[model samples]
Target chain A: MNDDALPPARAIEFWFDFGSNYSYLSMMRIEALATARNVRIVWRPFLLGPVFRQLGFENSPFVLQKEKGAYVWKDMERQCRKYGVALTRPSTFPRAALLALRVALYGANEPWIGAYCRKIMQLNFADDREIGLPEVVSEALGSLDLPAQHIIETAQSDANKLHLREQTEAAIRRGIFGAPTFFVGDEMFWGNDRLDDALDYCEAMSRRDR
Target chain B: MNDDALPPARAIEFWFDFGSNYSYLSMMRIEALATARNVRIVWRPFLLGPVFRQLGFENSPFVLQKEKGAYVWKDMERQCRKYGVALTRPSTFPRAALLALRVALYGANEPWIGAYCRKIMQLNFADDREIGLPEVVSEALGSLDLPAQHIIETAQSDANKLHLREQTEAAIRRGIFGAPTFFVGDEMFWGNDRLDDALDYCEAMSRRDR
Candidate 1:
């Protein structure tokens, strides 16, 4: 019923990027829903920049398509209202997520990963802070009572950088072209709206095994 | 609680394209949901091709993004299963929706629009028939006991063609960039996932007024 008892593939693999707005919604809300369903979450932090590049775009689809970009901002407002989350439109879109992503990668398997991600998302989305800065990221980790400087240093190391790269490549291999994608077994569910559907699938699968 | 009693802007404006896979999902399920909520449905049929072209894309985003295209087909299968609807992979994608869209435009304000749209969607997504053909459209109308030849002729008239063009232009002006878009007084909700959300919003607004 808990993380330890569940099979590795039985849990939902949550692949997301720090810079993704919709990912902010999932990062904020996924835990409570998963816990209620007794489903475990495997946080997999990766960059979407490379994914977009591979798809022949140098920017987010929101940026590439102007009408879509406008609709997204408006939609974000409505979605935030519906989800009861605060949203301050980021002045700098797609802020350099490298540092925050690497740091999230540092805590991916830890209990603190969820807290760290939520903190980073709050900085970027809720507060409109430049989350790409080391100071911002450090402060977020420090606020969580973690050794901020040490974690940031470790996250920036060449080996961890390689880990992040491999993770993004893995996401591409899994056919992920967008953020906030969830995988329950081999079934992939994209977008924040599908989070519930993904968790439902996970719970159903677990029940079947019982 | 009926369509006559609801205010014009209070009802949900459903903008869709015949070729859009997500639109198929919404078209099939919208009526029952709308009826339950005592919300009126204003069907607005438009072509996405021109919208995509205006955004500088010559084809659907699904065609432009390969990984996304593959994911969409897979997602369609999952969505169809979840909705308890049959799905046969269309041998031809984006099959000339021009004719079907024009026909739907002719029935936009009519009660038969929903049935016509569902029939067209079934022909394309459920039955794997080439819905772009005139005869396929005629047969679909005939099955509904409507005057097939007459409707087809009227739908193809220059004036109706003008109406369809103006509708597509209207969609672009309204900042719509995707299919299965719903509007409740300028509140735009895009994609099939947001259909229920849109309906709920409509019902909530109606309740507040009462």
Candidate 2:
């Protein structure tokens, strides 16, 4: 099809929280996968804390379910190995991702969003770096050749903070109870394992529309 | 290799609960998948009730997490559609599977275990039948040409009941917090989505041993 007459690009809305290990897995790989399938990625940065609270827990389900928590770390190790990626056990499970998430929200539609998210995920999950610190987030942004300090200030602005909160609220309204959730229209797929299914669904929908 | 010189068959330990919808998904398909790969399935029937209690919930986590519970049912519909399986949302979620589990446990090592498990799962997830009823359990066994009443009697025996309880405790000790878990030795893979991964792991391990 000619550029002017081309149909709208297929898009998958990716809802993720930087603190979530599983989200780390999806964030590190979704870009390449979506690109291969010619699907657009709509980055949705949100906090899982509110969602978890609504689900009747003050902490991450992993922290509440001790055995499952242990299983997750082991599973992550095996999964990272299978994917040929790096994973280090973070000293703090669910390390503070508030600043990182805000930064992500600020860059949600920006071209650098994917690389920025991968860097933050790598810092938290692969390098086990303390990503809660402003400097760590700044470093991740700086590596992206973005205006780190200015972006951080913008992210911390009242309007941006409200935007992040509203985004998380929207996630809850959209039936998102966990991070690494993907949406091809209203079809929701949870977990990193469903990443492929989500993209496949998106591609199929685009084909059917065409 | 000659029969006497042949290595032991590759096996995957399938730990499932009769009441688990996800387990139902796995039960419906694991047989053909295992057969195609020449992987033996060692059925391990266990109760998720006690496991949930151990995880600090008296009910299924789905019941405890309202949003997640809703998400699960919807996700189940999508997943069943994707797998081309029939799914009728049961009248009661997590229908009591005590007797069914006991029966499955009694037949854990028997050749008909797979068929018996699938029948019970179909009753609960596909037909919306009350699997908790003895007659329902009997019907499943009868379809397999098994001695329905006799199997029921044996399944209810104090010894079989105790075995079922012990098996659940074993599941807890093995870091199993959910149903439809698979193990290729000490490596545990949880959920229906991990079925293929578990089988692959089993096959790979067997190859390495060979």
Candidate 3:
């Protein structure tokens, strides 16, 4: 049923964290896959820090459970290879997503945001670049021909920071517990593998609605 | 790449926990999918208790993270409905897998094991039965025309019990951290969603080897 080879009428909300390796999987392939299926994707970038804090998790669940953490690193390597995405394990995991997410919130309506995200993901995963640096983010924006300096300044503005916070809260209230969560209308699908299922649901609902 | 339509020269290992809802999902769907794809599945039933305890956890991570716990239950219902597998949440989650797993170890080489497993899954999920009770498991075995009393008696024997323990340790050593993990060759894929992907790899490898 190669849903990706369809008309993009239905829309789905996609939530991701820059530091999430699994999220990198979705970010790498989601746009093209969704476009082929004819589904519209609304990228909603949010910080995982606040969400984890609210849940009383002092550390990433992966780090808390060493085995799961080990599996994730291995899984990321395997998945990246399978997906044809260049991947090099970053020196640090769960790199600061605040700055990247802030810029993302500011550019939600801009087409360059997607490319900017892919660049950040490539930096963190494929190139082992530290995404926490302001310069790294600035460079990502510059390459996209977007207003790098202006967007970076606005991203640091108190209002944009709060917006990212509120968005993270919305994700929590909406029952998201993992990265790469997709919502077709209000129904959510978690994980990179469920991308197709999420799009299928959106397409079916769009037809039913019309 | 309809792996299911190919020759059955490849084999994949299927790891499962009787008490896991997600495991039930793979238990219900894997056989038909594998047979159609001609992939042989070596069912590995194991206990998650020792694994969790060794990681210094006194509770299921699902239970520890309330939100993930709640989401898992809901996801199970949605997935069951989608898979057309009758589902009724058991009164207890992560019901003791020791007794069931011991019997599974005893029956690992028997042809009746798969049906016995399906029955146990139905009892736990679709019937809302107490799988922690020996009688419930006994009844599940009875339905499959197997030697319920003999199996139950031997399942409690020290040797069989130890086999179950050794199997779990092997799983941990192999870097398994979750239920329903699949392994094609040496590569592992976690979660029920990766079942098809694992099998596809197995088929591809088999073709390459030939």
When 1 and 2 are scored with DockQ, the better candidate is 1
In model 2, the runs with Cα more than 4 Å from the true position are A1-9, B1-9
Error of 3 at B202 (Å): 2.0
Q: Each candidate's TM vs. the true structure?
A: 0.94, 0.93, 0.91
* Chain A superposition TM-score per model: 0.95, 0.95, 0.92
- Order of models, best TM-score first: 1, 2, 3
CA lDDT for candidate 1: 0.87
Residue-level lDDT of model 1, residues B83-187, one tens digit each, is: 999999899888777888899988888878888899999999999999988999999999899999999999999999998888888888888888989988868
- 1 or 3, greater by lDDT: 1
Which DockQ values do the candidates obtain, in the order shown? 0.79, 0.74, 0.58
Residues B40-119 of candidate 2 have per-residue lDDT tens digits of: 88888988999888877889878877777988998899899988889999999888889999999888879999889989
lDDT of 2 by residue, A114-142 (tens): 99999999999989899999999999998
Cα shift from native, residue A64, model 2 (Å): 1.7
Candidate 1 per-residue lDDT, tens place, A120-172, comes to 99999999999988899999999999999999999999989998998898888
> Measured by TM-score, how close is model 2 to the native structure?
0.93
Model 3 misplaced regions, further than 4 Å:
A1-9, B1-9
Residue A160 C-alpha lDDT in model 3:
85
